[model samples]
Target: MENRRFDIRKSLLRALFASLCGVSANAMATEQYPCKPAPDEGRFAWGRIQSIDPNYLVKRILGPYTFKIPYGYMIGRPTPERLNCYPKQNRLEFAFWMPDFRAPKKDMWSEPNYRVHEPGRDAPGPQEYVVDVVGLEFIETKAGKSGSPGRRFVNGLALLRKDFRIEETYGLIHVVPGQNTPLSDDYVSLSNEGYEILLECSRPESRDSNPSCKAYLYFTDLQLEAVMQFPADALPEWQKIKDGVRILVERWIVKEKPT
Candidate 1:
């Protein structure tokens, strides 16, 4: 009886140790790739404050899709007037810092000097990119029945041209016909809201040695329209940047295992 009791205590100790080790492993994994789990339906619906982690990998459910947004990406906070929460069907606005971009330790989303670029004072600041994802319903409102992705893209270009007065203004257009013509299919050069924007209608064929443009892309693969804004100088490596953004979006999606 005494030997049996000793064996039972040994087994219990082994089980406890194993459990603690498993927990430690999980904690380490979380530290390496910290991600906030999906919020409950009630919390999402009520626009309640969920986790307070600065490096939040928010999980959002929109229609048929579930997105697990990674860290360095800022999720749109819900407001009293505009409750931009989960299970949303219309539009969602989010922003992300490029992988190379170094974000602040805290309040990265609301940092005042995020866009400031003052050489000598400090290191070069990375550009901030904003993206807007809209559903078919929102697209229908913008462009009528023939609101195909191609059509919407064309319309966007037309709107930008008209609004920026590209024809009327000189030097507004960055490309100089034969001098600095971009390798990309289409490039729009204009300044809006204090930022010089270089819009790309489609992917580029090759990288330019002295590419003089940022990037704005319209993606329709998510069953929703996604409009992206990034620094224009990155245009030379547009394909890589495009791929990176696509990868980020793809990673966010929670894939289901085969049954």
Candidate 2:
């Protein structure tokens, strides 16, 4: 009877140890990704790496996405009243979509699940606007891997398609040169001048090899989708800001185990 009691105690101790180990692993994973700050020389755009509590961020928010901007630009806390200030200067801001409170199953999906939006109508069709209303057409990139068939999202959808001149590509991310350009697409009439670049992760349904990514992509190990924009007709020299843009984002590398 003594030997039996000893065996049961050992089993309980083993279970407790396993639970602690799991928690420790998660903390270690969060610690592994550190914030990297880029230097500001007053010539080109300036950006700094910052951190936020994972719990305070959106349900899926994994890390920080800094807004890279020029020397004299003013920064403001995001609000409906502050919308006018963005166009006053070469502005950079972060956007967060409200969770779908109406439908529980569609909570993680950024867009309203039951509603369908199109260019002229409010209906889901062949090119149904399944994604958010702002930039529905561009969410699913045509450049996804062969078998994966996943899509990528560019933040500030209206700015990307109309205002910013998408100049180059750093891997899958679109690099927007800071040049001010005329509105080419008639779809978006709001912004007349700006610059922007986008970094997007593969959507869950895309069959990508990365298991950590999903639709409501805040759970990914890295900063999956982000956009930096500026109010300008002509972009300043690129040599100063390009490195800052790349370095600020590189800090968020995909982890093997997401927290």
Model 1 over residues 123-159: C-alpha lDDT tens digits?
5444443222212222332344322434433565544
**In model 2, which regions exceed 4 Å deviation?**
1-22, 25-225, 254-259
Q: Can you give the TM-score per candidate against the true fold?
A: 0.42, 0.23
Model 1, runs deviating above 4 Å: 1-51, 78-89, 99-122, 125-149, 156-221, 255-259
What's the true lDDT of residue 214 in model 1?
29
- Residue 198 lDDT in candidate 2: 25
Model 1 clash count equals 3
**Model 1: how far is 108 from its true place, Å?**
6.8
Clashing pairs in 1: 213-232, 214-231, 214-232
Model 1 Cα shift for residue 99 (angstroms): 4.4
* Candidate 2 similarity to native, TM-score: 0.23
